[model samples]
Target: MESNDELVDGMIKAMERLKSGDPALNTLASYLYKADHRLYEYLDKLKIYTELEKPTPQQTQDAGKLLEKIVFLLFKGLEGLQSVKSFQSAGPQYDLLVSGDDIGWKVVCKTLYLEWENRDIVIEAKATKSPLEDKQFARLCSIMEHNLRGAGLGIFVTLNGASGFPKRDSTRQRAVSDCRLRQIIFHARTNKIIVVLDKEDLFQLTKNGTLIEILIRKIRDLSELSGLPTTPAEQFQEIDLPTHLKMLYHSNG
Candidate 1:
């Protein structure tokens, strides 16, 4: 069995190789592609070990934290490579203007605008250890549209895996229905939603290259709200993983 130390060392090496553009970058990419699969494998084994037991509340919380960390890391990695500015905006009225009647109320416009090559995106990072409901997902979408009009993208980082949930599962469906593959136009004018599912769901999707292409294409399109072309290669070129990872390591050090 690979010891935890061994795994850590291997991961560090892989990340470094990727940063240096080593020929081994290909291998590292393959490994990352399987990350969700390995995570699911471990989860399945854990499920077997706890056959008669349900995950405790505290255990669920811990699991949620772990998943959140993974999503955060993924975003950080991608952000590093891109040439966009991203920072947490003020508060609820991050963007847009809301108005009531003549003597009514209005939310101040956003600090950022949807200018060419400059897009504003709001990210809501959340975690769930169990099945999620439709109301929760719908609520997220509503918040994005109502408050952030020129918002080009809305990303939902979810843990506790959304797979095994049915399509007819109104809750799961609603969670992502706003951006179905066929409903492309609707997202074009508004925030294109991206649900980064837990490790398990990500793994299953990898079995089909087509699915990966679809997701990349969708994200590419969403990213283009800044007047960029919709291309995965171009998007990645915009990501600066090497520098970002170095900063992360030094900060922790």
Candidate 2:
């Protein structure tokens, strides 16, 4: 590792540049650097990631890095969940993997605690601006099945949401339909859950509920939509959804 003096000097220089380079980020950075660093209060830090996100049709290295950072913050900031490890390309195919435990009992609702406790959470990111295609989603499933075996849950964090529609060719809706069909198959075969969330969904979630609460809702909603119920159905209770999340959950279903 570099000398401590070098690290401190680097931090000082980076802070100076941040103050001059980006006014908004400079403000956030100062707040974080000075504050108590409590995770609950730090939840607001998502603003930085949202501000930096600039999706393009062509994927860029910055897009992937931003997403990885966002997901890492989410797993750590959300009440009750704990991040066990994160892998960009070093671990499995997962971007960030968290293991849910009872530690969330203090900060999360009891229902969420019981559901997620002891389960493994897997997240995959797509930085491109286009909706996730069937093939792309299938890759996530394949990874979960073969690589991260026994992982209880999976999420697709996409910029443009997932594709699945009816009566269309491979362009849009048809791609969505294929993804849904695969979801059903995967759930039936493995009895696990995977859901998709676009950047907009992430933004709305910041308003609807705590990070973990919204995630619970999304997981159950996906399980219900798949028609292989019993678990998500009986265990899930009705809660008013933010209009955006409601619409995005299963648009063509």
Candidate 3:
């Protein structure tokens, strides 16, 4: 049951995209298109920071700040998740608390004494020349474990990507350390999950509004590892979540 006026409004909005003349571009679809372009722009800037051969300390600092904004903006822009960000006096930690009503997953779960509940997600960024190594990952773990009270999930955003298996050309130490720390958090006894995302992942997110979807896949990747039999570390490398998404729209010629 729909009113004629309301139905007409819907028709007009739909026709906005079909119009051959100058489009107002104020519809929801137009909004999303603009958002995607903006995200890609940010992603390009981040990649530029990584290209400098010998950036001054200040340049590095600026890149890190940009990463914070990118992380906040990308997660904040996600459709389903409700988020709040605060960069506190204790260094450049951008804290985002994601509501679980829509993103209900074990990766973001917290114990409510008698049962499990969706826990807040913490996002942190470390934009380095190469992917972050063991030292950085370990430090983040310690900070999250001790200071960020009640949080069980953390998303670490890096410039390059997470360390890979033995065959991985990067530092092997980082790969081992990442897995060790993950093991600690993934244990049934503990209820925490850490997801690491690189610049590529963010770029992919820019194309389609799939930040939350990529996170879910990543969460499941680490979570499911615990239930299955242990696999050698050399087998794993970074994951490419998704590149682009297109919807189906057909018309008569």
lDDT leader: 2
lDDT (0 to 1) per candidate: 0.38, 0.53, 0.52
Off by over 4 Å in 3: 1-37, 80-83, 89-97, 100-118, 164-188, 224-253
Candidate 2, number of clashes? 5
Greater TM-score among 1 and 3 belongs to 3
Model with the higher lDDT, candidate 1 or 3:
3
Query: Candidate 3: TM-score?
Result: 0.59
lDDT per residue (tens digit) for residues 1-253 in model 2: 9996566445444443332224332222211111113433323443344455563433366657766666666555543354467655654455777764443322232233223332676788776656778887788788778777756678887665666522212222212256777777887887777777666545543321334444555555554563321122123345446688888865886
Instruction: Report the lDDT tens digits of candidate 1 across residue range 1-253.
Output: 9996577446644354232223343233322222233444444443443342567777766655554444433333321123223344454522111122110000000111123222434554455544344455555466566755644445444444233232322331222232232224435555345343433333333231222232343454443432222233223334324677868865856
User: Compared to the true structure, candidate 2 yields what TM-score?
Assistant: 0.56
Q: What does the lDDT come to for candidate 1?
A: 0.38
RMSD of each: 16.6, 15.0, 12.0
Model 3: how far residue 118 lies from native, Å: 4.1
